[model samples]
Target: MNNSLLIKYGLAGVGLDIVSSADICKHVFHTKASTKRMHTKNDNNNTEYSAVQSEPWSCTERCFPKLICCTYIHKTIANAFHPFIFIPGDGGSQVEAKINKTNSVHYICAKTSTDFFNIWLNLELLVPVVIDCWIDNIKLRYDNVTRRTSNTEGVETRIPGFGSTEPVEWLDPSHASTGAYFTDIGRLLYFTDIVNALVKLGHVRNQTLKGAPFDFRKAPNENQDYFVKLKQLVEETYESNGKTSVILLAHSMGGPMSQYFLNLQKQNWKDKYIKCLVTLSGAWGGSVKAVKVFAIGDDLGSYMLNGKVMKLEQITNPSLAWLMPSRNYWKMDEVLVQTDTKNYTLSNIEDYFMDVEYPNGWEMYQDTLPHSLNLTAPGVEVHCIYGTNVSTVEQVFYKAGSFYENPTLINGDGDGTVNRRSLEGCKTWSSKQKQKVYDLALPKVDHMGILKNVNVLEYISNLVNGL
Candidate 1:
C-alpha cells in the first residue's frame, strides 16, 4: 500500500448531525490551513492525492538507539492504520424535508438548503422571534402562577414551559410542522468546519453513508435503522481500506450515544473496529439545564437572541433527560439548592422527569440515568475535551414553598450550557478501569465554540497523528 493511504479517518458529529453547506466548508477550510495535497506515482500515472505525516519521534544515538527506532516504526505504522468516525452530538444530524400544499413530504439536499447563512443572515427577521420567545416565556411563567394567601400546602405552583424555544416560524414557508424541516443551527454548522479541517489534513476519509446521519431528536437506541446502516458502512470502510480500525470522535450527546452503540456490540468488536475514542464536550453526565427544563422549563431566547425564539416547555423528552449527569457518577443528592424562604436538596433530581409511570417497562430505562457507566468498551483508548470558564448554573431555587414556580439560578464555572462538573463526566469512568483516560478542560471555550476553535482542531489533529 502507498504511504498516502496509510491511515484512514472517520468523523462523527454532535446532535442534529446534518451535512453542512459546501460554502461553509469552503469558507472554514480556507480560514485556517489549506488541504495538504501531494503527488504520488500510481500504476498507470502520477496522481495528486491527500497525505498526512505524523510529527517525528526523536532518539539520542548515544543511548537507546534500538529502542527509539522500534518506537518510531511502531508509531508510524499505527498512524497509517486507523480511520476516524465522528458521531455528531444531539441535533448534529437532521434531514431537511419540505411539504407541499397537498401535504406530501419532499426532502431537499441542495446547497441553499444546507446553507445557514441564508437563514440567519437577516438579523431583523431572526432577532424578533428570539425576543418574542423570551417575552412569551416570561408571560408563560406569570400566567401559570397560582398565587398563594399564606404558602398553603397541597397547592402546587404552575410551571412555565422553558428551555429551548422551537422556531416554528423559521420552518420552510411551505411546511407547517416542527420536524417537517430541519431548522437547527447545531446541525447545519456543528461539524462542517471540523470536516473541512480534517479533509484538508489529508489521509482522513469520510466513510459515512449518504442521508444516514442519526436523528438527533430520537433516542439513540431507537434508531435501529441508523445503527444497522452504520454497521454496514463501518464494514464497508474496513473492507475497502485494508481493515483499518476506527477512531471515533464523539461530541456532546454523541458521547453517550457512542457508548450506547459500543455497548451493544460484541465484546470483541472494539478490537476489530475501534482504535481510540476522543470526545469533545461530551455530555456523559446529563446537563443541569436539561433537568431544569424537565422540572420547570426555560426561556432560551433571552440568553441567545439568534433568530429563533425557543421556549422549552415543562414536558418530558427521554432523550433530553438522557443528557443529565449520571447518578452513578455524580453525588447529585448532595448538591444544595436554596429558595427565598427555604433550602432544599436533590436526592435524585432525575426523579422529577420520570414521575409518570409508563405502561411498558420503558419506565425502567428512563428511571436509570447512569446505565452508561456499565457500557464502557474495554481496551479502547479514551480522550476527553470539554469547555469551561463560563458561569454555570449548577442548581435552581424556587419561591419559598413553591415546588415548580419562581425558579432562580446559582452559578459555577462551565461552558454557557454544560457545567464543568458535568463536562468532566468522562472522569466517572476512571475508577471503573485501569486504562488511562485523558481529559483537557479549556478555559473560555463555550460548548459550540469548541468546533471553531483552531487550538482544539490542532489538538485533535495531533491526537489523530499519534494514533
Candidate 2:
C-alpha cells in the first residue's frame, strides 16, 4: 500500500518496530508462537529498541505490503447508560457542497466541480472577496409553489456524518487554519468540548452518543425525511443500548426542532424511547434577534464581519423565519424594531418585511409561523438550561436614510444572543404537560459559553450519570 494512503487511514504514526518478529512469523506461516517483548540494540549507533508483543492475525501482502504484523488496540466497554442524541442549532453542522452550476455569478466562481468541499466553517471561503462566492454557493432558493427551499441552482449540499458526533464536533473536518487561531472566540461553533466531556463520562461515540445535524437552512416543516431518519436512529440506538431510553440534548434552534420532532411522535413512543429532553439556551419562543436579522441582517455575533454580506443567504433560509419572534412570547404592542416614522411589532411583521423591500420574506415567515406558534408541550420530561444577565438585542432602531444600513440596538436581559423571555419560555411547559420540567438559568453565561461552561458541563455530567 502507498504511504500516503496509510497516512490517510491514520496508521502512519504506528511504528512497525513495535510489532515483534515472532508475531509476524506466526501470522505468515501458521505456526504457534509464544508472545514476548523483545529488546535489541543497533550495532552502528548503539540505539536500543523495544518491541511489544503483538496479537497474531491474518495479513496479506496487498493490505500491508512489507509489514506482516498488526496491533489490536483495546477499547473499554461502557456500562448501560442513557444514549444521547445531540441536535445542533442553525449553522452548527458542517455542510459540504459540490459545484455543478451551468452559470456563474462571478467569473472567479467555479461553474463545475468534481469534489465536495466544506462550505460552512471553512474560514478560507469566509474571507473578504471569497465570502461572496461562499454566500452564493450556500444560499437556498425558495419555490413559491412548493413552499419549500432548495440549494442554489447547480450546487448540491449534504450534511456529513449524520449519525456520528465527529461532523458536529468539528464542523470543518480539516479544522481550517483559521479555526485554530480563533478557537477561543466561541465554543458553540464546535461541540468538541461537550463531546470530549461525554466520552470522559463513559459514553462511547456513535454507540451511546450520536449527532443529528440537518440542513439548517430549512425549517422542520420541510424536514420530513430528516424526522423519519431521526426516529429510526433513536429506535436503533435505544435497541442497541439494551433498550435504554435516550436523552435528547439540544442547543438553540435544536431545542425547538427536537420539540417539534417529539410532538410528531405518539405519547407512548415518547414515554418508552425518550429518557428526557435537555436543552441548552433553548430559543423556545423565538428571539428578537431574528427580527434584526430580517431588518438589516446580522453578522451572527461576529463584530468584525459585515452582516450585509451574508444577508442574501441568511434571509433566504426558512429556518431563520421559523426562529422569528413568536406572538406567544412577544406582546402585540411591544416594538421590536423602531424607525424614524414607524415602530414594528410582532403583529406588524408583514409590514416590517414590506418596508424592508423584501416582500418574499413575509411569505416565508407566514409559511413557517404556524409551525412554532403554539409551542406545544412535547409530553416528555424536560430540563431547560439557559444563560441570562447578559445584554441581548431586544430592539433595533433605524434612521431615515439608513433603513437597511447601520442601526442602533436596544439591549435587554438575555444570553447575549436570545432574549430572556424566549430563553425562559420553556418554563411555560411546566404546567402544560404531565412530565416534570426543570429550568436552569446560569448567571453571566452567554449563548455559546453555555456549551463549555464548567458549571453546565458538571450539571450535564451529573444528569447523565444519574440517569
Candidate 3:
C-alpha cells in the first residue's frame, strides 16, 4: 500500500505523484468484503471493505496501461455525471492512458484510479478502478431528440456541448452531434457549457415562444454501451501494465450506468475484472421530469416522435392550473433565434412542435424497475454521492406542478433536466447505501456545477478511503 494521496481538484493542487510500485501478477481478488455507508449517523461510523461473489478473471502476462475517458457532452464535469478527471497529455485533447505513471488534473484522483483503492500489495498499484470524465449537456442529446434538423436550406444541426455564442465542436458522438471537428480544449468545456445551457432554458424555452434547446433523458441501453467500452479500455490498461484492479467513481447518471454495468458483470462478468464502483446523484428511479411531463404537460407525451421520448413530460395526466407558473409571458413576435454563426440557426422545439408522441420505451423501463435501487445493492460494494442544489435549478426551470402539466409554461429546480428529489430518491437513507455524502447536496449548486466544485473531493476521498 502507498501513503494516502490527497486529491485537491477545486483548490490549488495537482494530481497524485506516485513512487511507482512493483507489478504483481497472479493475485486473488477477495469477494467477501462489504463496504459501509457515507460517514453519517446511520452506520455509526464504520469502515470495512469487501468484493463481489463471482468467478474472477485471470491476468495475462503483460505491462498494460488502463486509460478510459468518457464525454457526457464534450467536457470534464457534468451536473449529472461523476467528476472523474485526468491530466491533459502533450497531445492536448486526444484521450491518452499509461500503465506505470499517472497523468492527473485533480489532487485526490490524480493518482491512477487504481491508487484510490486501499489494496494490500507490495510494489505497483494494481486494483480495479473506473474513471468517468463525462460532462452533462443541459440540452441533452439522446434518442428522443434528433441531433440535426432539415430547414429551408437543408438540414440544420445542433452541435454537441456548445452555445450559439461559441464555436461548434463535435465528438465521436455516441449521444448526438455530427459534422466538423470538436477540439480537445473544447471538450474540457463540456460540463460547464451543459450546466449553463440547461440553466438558461427556463428563460429560452419557457419565456420565449420559439422554445429552448434540446433535452434528452438518455437511454439505459446507450449508457450501458459506454460502460462496456470503458470496461474494455480498462482491461487494455491492465494488459498494458502488469495487472491491476480499480475503484470505480461515477457521478449522477453514471451511477445508474455503473449499476447497470455491475448487474451485467454479476450475471455474465463473473470472470470480468472490476474492482469497485462509486456513484453521485444517480437516478436509479426514473426522473421526476418524466413523471411530471406525463402527469402535467399537455398531450405532450403524444410528441414522442420516431424513437424519441418526449422531454420531461413523464406522466400521463395533469391539472392545468397547477402546471402554469405565472401569467407574465415574455412578449415577443418571433420566438425563433438565429445565431451570428451560420452553423446553429435552427430550433427543434418549433420544427418538431406539432409532431409528438409518448415514449413506450420509458413505459417498459418504469414497469420493470419503478425504482430499482440496485446500484447500492449488497453483492457489490457501491458508494453514493447525493446533491442538495436542486432548489436553484428548480426555481429557474420548474414551478411546483410543472412536471405534471405545461412544462413549456413553467420551470423548476434541478439543472433544468432532473429534479433534486428525484435524484436523491424517494427514500432518504437506506441500510444498503454506503460511502455516501449528503452535504454535497448544497443549495447553491446545480446539476452541472457540482461536477466542477473543489469541495466535493474531501467527501469523495473520505468515501473512497472508507470504502
Superposition error at 186 for model 1 (Å): 5.9
Pick by lDDT: which candidate is best? 2
lDDT of each: 0.50, 0.78, 0.30
RMSD (CA, angstroms), candidate 3:
21.2
Between prediction 1 and prediction 3, which has the larger lDDT?
Answer: 1
Q: After superposition, how far is residue 123 of candidate 3 from its true place, in Å?
A: 47
State the RMSD for candidate 1.
14.3
Q: Which residue pairs show backbone clashes in model 2?
A: none
Name model 3 segments beyond 4 Å from true: 1-218, 221-227, 238-242, 267-275, 291-378, 392-417, 426-440, 461-467
Best by TM-score: 2
RMSD values, in order shown = 14.3, 9.4, 21.2
Instruction: Give the Cα error of residue 145 in candidate 1, in Å.
Output: 31
Compared with the true structure, what per-residue lDDT tens digits does model 1 show for residues 1-467?
22332222111111112222222232222222223334465553534343433332233422335455445543443345456666766545422321112211123212121222212212222244343322222111111122101111211222111111112112122223322122323323556556555544544333321112465544553455667766676666555445677667777877777777766677577668766678888877666766455554554323334211232322323455456555554574555455565443446443443432211112323533445445464356688898999877787777666765546777777886787877886776677666568888889987767877788889876875665
Model 1 earns a TM-score of: 0.60
For candidate 2, the lDDT comes to 0.78
In terms of lDDT, which candidate is stronger, 2 or 3?
Answer: 2
Residue-level lDDT of model 3, residues 13-126, one tens digit each, is: 111121111111111121111222222222423221211123333343122222211122112221111222111111111111211223332343333333222111100111
